[model samples]
Target: MLTLAHALLPRIHHLAVPLLSGCSNDLSSRRAATGPSNFSIFNRRPTAENRSRLQALLSEERYLALDSYQTFGSNKKNKEQEATKHTKDIKLQDGSGTNSCQEQNSCLENQLETYEWQLKILHAVLTASGEQEREQLLKDHSGDICTLIHSISDKVKTEVRTDLNELHEKHLKSISEQYQSEAEELRRIHREETAALNEVFASSEKTLKEEIEGLTSELKLFKELKRRVEESTLKRDLQRNIETHGSPGEFWEQEQESLLFVIEMKRQHLQEQRSKLLQMQSMQNEDFKVRMENYQSLIQQLSREQNELQEALEQQALQKQKLSQEKEELLFKLLQQRTDSCSSFQLPPVLHTHLSPS
Candidate 1:
């Protein structure tokens, strides 16, 4: 019922504004015809002597003729102000001092009928109480549907205030408790990890110094081999680019596999380097002899340049993973936003449920 009323309001305003404009023109015509009420409507009454005065008055009121939207808004505001004055008070046409039992029953019956209609409207809105979180929404706010008609009639200011305050307080307390629990868990983990990383970093640095000396020599050899590999890869990429120059889309589609292959090779190279680092990290935990020959056997034939290229590739892999994650997260956030908008559009069927009277 409320939705129907709301839908009607704008169309009504559209219709009413033009009607009023017509009436105003009629009134102005009447004013012009005052001296001769029976005069034809098309007849002009402005005299030559009063022409300047008439022009000035018309110019000042020109805004009324040109600005229909402004006029409609002003009229709507006046209506709201009038309705506000009627709040908490109903006017009876007859100003009788007293009413008999039959008259009183008839008045009560009329009020019941009106209330029933209001109840039906409320039911429609309540069906949307899945809480789309829209303010100034048309939904029935069915949270208070448990209240009886008698209770509704006798609702006091204190009752409303208390309900609102209680809901707010309860909501606040839950939010605070949730925050505190998360903070406490984070603090506990920080304390535990700080001590562990300190001890490990101290031991790891000593081992890393010993391994670096051994690995440097091995990396020098690998560096030469890696340079040749990158040069070969670049040449292949250039050849492919030249071969498929006509269509960019088709070229990219063909290149996808090659790009993925290159990325995979780079990933494998990083994994190999990471495995070497992991060994050093783990060697610190072992009880084996401090023989430097084990480091020699463990070290690959990679040269210094290969190690540097491998490090750069590892960084690129990390960045690529981060980018992929961010893209997924952005799409997920967009999907969530779309879901929220769709939620707001609770159809008439769902709203009809909560809107129904208890």
Candidate 2:
């Protein structure tokens, strides 16, 4: 069943949600006109709107009773599930039972639903025989039969049981005078049941009286509330009419003033927000500007050092050229002395120049 409900949940929600949403307007309209919805105890195929309406109508006790009902339902479902398992176990062990009997057996736990539906098969069997045989038949079907009758008319069962118990108690006290020895034991058992039923009857009567009083109080309150609502509605209509046709110039002036006040409030709010945004943006821009300035200053300093290094390289190159020229001159003088002593080879001319550092 859980698996089945799980699979069906999306579909159920899909179907139910639209219906529930559509109902909400009606519920809200009803509440606005009156108060809460009528139902406070019973919930039948409840929609979301119905649930909301019920919440307003329900007292704390009624709400708690709903919780108790859910818990009780859960317990009953667990018992039915156990009974189903028991039936399945019986089926697994033997294959002798007819299909109809098996179906009836499987439906045994559901006997709690309706007396007629549950006891159909039992009545069919019982009516096919005589009274002596009927007693034997009734004994065989006692479980299913009792459950069906009790499930169908729970109040009737209680009342009948009470009557039987009283009869038994009377019989027990007057056993020698009234009942035979064979009936004595039954009388004792019957007496015990009567006492219990009388107590239940008394309690039920008290509960009903309390419920009636509470309902009466609630009805009185509802009538008072209705009167007040009608008065409020009338006042609202009168105010609307007054606003419709009176003193156009003065009305427009007041409306203008209200509009201006609203605008001023909004303007102040927006202005504050704008100023905060500008301050944050300007702070970021200032930080960016500082970093840009630092970068430009670093570039200028690097350029100055680059020019100085170039000037130093020029001075070093000039010094090297002067040294090379002096060595060439000394060599030329030696060559000229060799030529004056009777040499035939001619020497090439060389120019020497010097550059200072910039």
Candidate 3:
């Protein structure tokens, strides 16, 4: 058992060393290569590959560890039973004969205690407790715990990393899908808008084309009606002139003669009007002379009346001045008469002075 335990120790060390170092190197390299990867979203293959490798190594290491522990556990159980029986046998022996038995019992108890200690360490490592508990276990069994911890910690790290990777991949996938769906919706909206705009533009263009056609037809009809009316009026006038005259030559000669006769009549009428105008002009000149004499006589009479009126106004102003002076003298006499009448009463000097006018 001792030799087997020693052989297993080296083997466990060999197996644990490579795994711990490899996992450490990988973790450090990954951390260094992808610094502050809080927003990383692209790389997944490398992590998956590393996870697969870790899972394989961890599975193999875990199977070996559990297998070794199972054999150890079974052996420990058998040894415990045997030690219990042997302790009972030592207890049954005589008191003086118990020295060698007690020594052997002590040796067996120590061996069992060491085995139990080792079992406790294994249990603590497998259970993967809190930091304090782990630290305590490590302090109690540093060498054995070191070998066990490397494999167990790597397994735990691999599981946590795998879970995180899976979660990250799911999140990235969900975000990508959502983005794609939104982009597709936006594209659909754009297409609908484009189609609607195209329809509106087509309808507007069609309406404009129809309006242009209608206007063009109306313009053509207006031009045709105007031309027809002008032609009809021209034809009627020509027909009436043809009926009045014998032929085109006769019409032209008659028109020329009629125009000459009308011109001669107008000239005669104008001459008579000119003679009447000359007579009226002479009569107006005689009336204007008579009116000028009347106007001059009226102007002389108005001027004489204006001078007489001005003299009357000046005489009135002088009479008004004399009346105002006489009124003032009468007012003074009336005041003096009042003062003389008031003197009989022996009025106060102040009253007399107040009654006197300035």
TM-score of each: 0.18, 0.23, 0.33
- The true-structure Cα RMSD of candidate 3 reads 51.6
RMSD per prediction, one decimal?
Answer: 34.6, 58.1, 51.6
> Please, what is the whole-model Cα lDDT of each candidate in the order they appear?
0.46, 0.46, 0.53
lDDT tens digits by residue: candidate 1, 235-346:
6876777677844566556567777897798789878987987786678546333433443333332234345555655565566557656755775575455444323324
Model 3: runs farther than 4 Å from truth? 1-142, 246-358
Candidate 2: what lDDT? 0.46
| lDDT (tens digit, per residue) of candidate 3 on 64-97 | 5556556765787787777886666776874443
TM-score of 1: 0.18
Q: Please, what are the lDDT tens digits per residue for candidate 2 over residues 23-108?
A: 33344454456544441111113445644543343333234334544664686577767777766777788854445543643464
lDDT for model 3, on a 0 to 1 scale?
Answer: 0.53
* Candidate 1 segments exceeding 4 Å error: 1-211, 216-228, 240-249, 285-358
